[model samples]
Target: MRVENLHCSKRINPLVNFLIVALILSPSLTIILIPISFLLIMVYNVIRFKLLEPSVTRDTHEKFLQFIGGEPYYMDLDTYGKKGGTYADAVAIDAHNLYVLHEDNAVEIPWSMVRSWTIQAPGADRVVGVGMTAAMTAASHNIEAAAKAHEASGLFVFVADVNHPKWQFRTADTTILRKWNEILTQRNEGLLAA
Candidate 1:
């Protein structure tokens, strides 16, 4: 389809609309259009930066990690039509043992819904030399470090708290997934116990 036809009818270029409105208003002695035009431009720029631009940086993922409170995660391409906006992919949590999140939407992972995700780096070098063994070792170490207080019982239960405000719920192993399911089941049973 043509570029002009790519957008929905409800959407139109802000600059074009602003110019048209300003021209029409100025002739009718409506100086308010000047400020309106400026406001529209500012809003357009903000939307462009936050929702449209997809340029990746060395710190893109890092920034996202900080947004989610520095948690480990995996990437998933999100092409879910209008909800995905302009980008073709997204970085999602590895809810499963595999690096893949399994479902296209993060909400489908039996946890809370995902607000948004983005890749920090779009460079090829990021994944080139990264070996799975090294990655797993580092992951295990991070888990151990993060789970220090909980490891005292010999059973390290990694729970995916999908409802947590900062991060999406995910674990490094399927055992944790099962454990979480069981925990939820038991908690639900308690509710039904009454």
Candidate 2:
């Protein structure tokens, strides 16, 4: 079963049409209007995704559950895509495997093939200065630290699969990271027992 979470065509068509009409009707204004229109679109998307469309995540989760035929041991519904877009991507763990669900495809990796996993806070390694005074350096360091603290965290998994060795999923909510750590600990303990 294939699940498509992105409706890019539906969203893009109207925007494209609007741009075309603007160019035809007022070519002189097109240059000015284009940037304004794009800025408005960006703001609208931020509002829609961050506030209005949380249901999209739930809906994607439901569809994935249907595809997998049961509840997963662990699942994160809110995850960013590979290129930092939100296409309702998800990461899940069943009894025997880990699953990465993208908009068009799904990858299943056996539990035995998961070499390791870590929760990585984004922007943690960002460098603040090339050459600056101590005061400036300290201030930059503080700002960078603050930014890192607020940035989305990601789950990075190292797998043995040749084709797809690494999988990463980013989420703004830190609770998801904690839950994933717990699940991984339990799974690891089970594996050691067996």
Candidate 3:
């Protein structure tokens, strides 16, 4: 399947984004920085794209079969979640359970155990966002482009077991976002294994 992968991580390399912001704020410097910035940005995005690329491994899939005892329909490793810094690979769901694989361990969470999944901005604090049209129109200096690029990128905090309410996985992958929307919606909740 085609992976949109890091919609935010691979968008514009941080340095290029910095340069763009710097130029936008100080337009006169573009006369000297423009050509150099363009070349640097092209190079940076290529390199960062390669480095930030996330993949699901053969071992991960094999292990899923062994432990979860089901064929994994989705898996990813450029994924990360924090239960106070625990998993790096995440949000894998099979027929009976959702598997969250940590750097050193894995948890098989039954579908029935899941209490809820919440979407929120990067930091613990949430910002009420403007609509796409308003966000774009207000971006006089394309500042909104930077903000909007990250609009869809946020942490998905889920409680796999209500008893362990303190236990949470905050996944920040674009694939996880899309998959959660598709597989865990109200319309699809009835389809989950009991």
- Tell me, by lDDT, which candidate is best: 2
For candidate 3, lDDT tens digit of each residue in 1-194? 11112112223344656766576467576444655554464465445545444423334445545665566765554433211221234456766666655443466766666666655434223234376544334432243344344443443435544444422233445555666666766424676553
lDDT of 1 by residue, 1-194 (tens): 00011121122356665675666466664555654554564465446545444432223334334433345433333221122222222233333221121111122222233223211211111222246555544544553454442222111222354443232222333344444444434433553221
Between prediction 1 and prediction 2, the one with superior TM-score is 2
Local distance difference test values of all predictions, in order: 0.33, 0.61, 0.47
Superposed by TM-score, candidate 1 places the C-alpha of residue 94 at a distance from the truth, in angstroms, of 5.1
- In order of appearance, the predictions have TM-scores of 0.21, 0.60, 0.42
Displacement of residue 19 (Cα, Å) in model 2 is 2.2
Which portions of model 3 show Cα errors greater than 4 Å?
1-56, 79-88, 120-157, 160-171, 186-188, 192-194
Q: Per-residue CA lDDT of candidate 2, range 20-98, in tens?
A: 5565466576555755554464464455446424555666667677766688766776633222234565788887877
Output the number of the TM-score-best candidate: 2
Total colliding residue pairs, candidate 1: 3
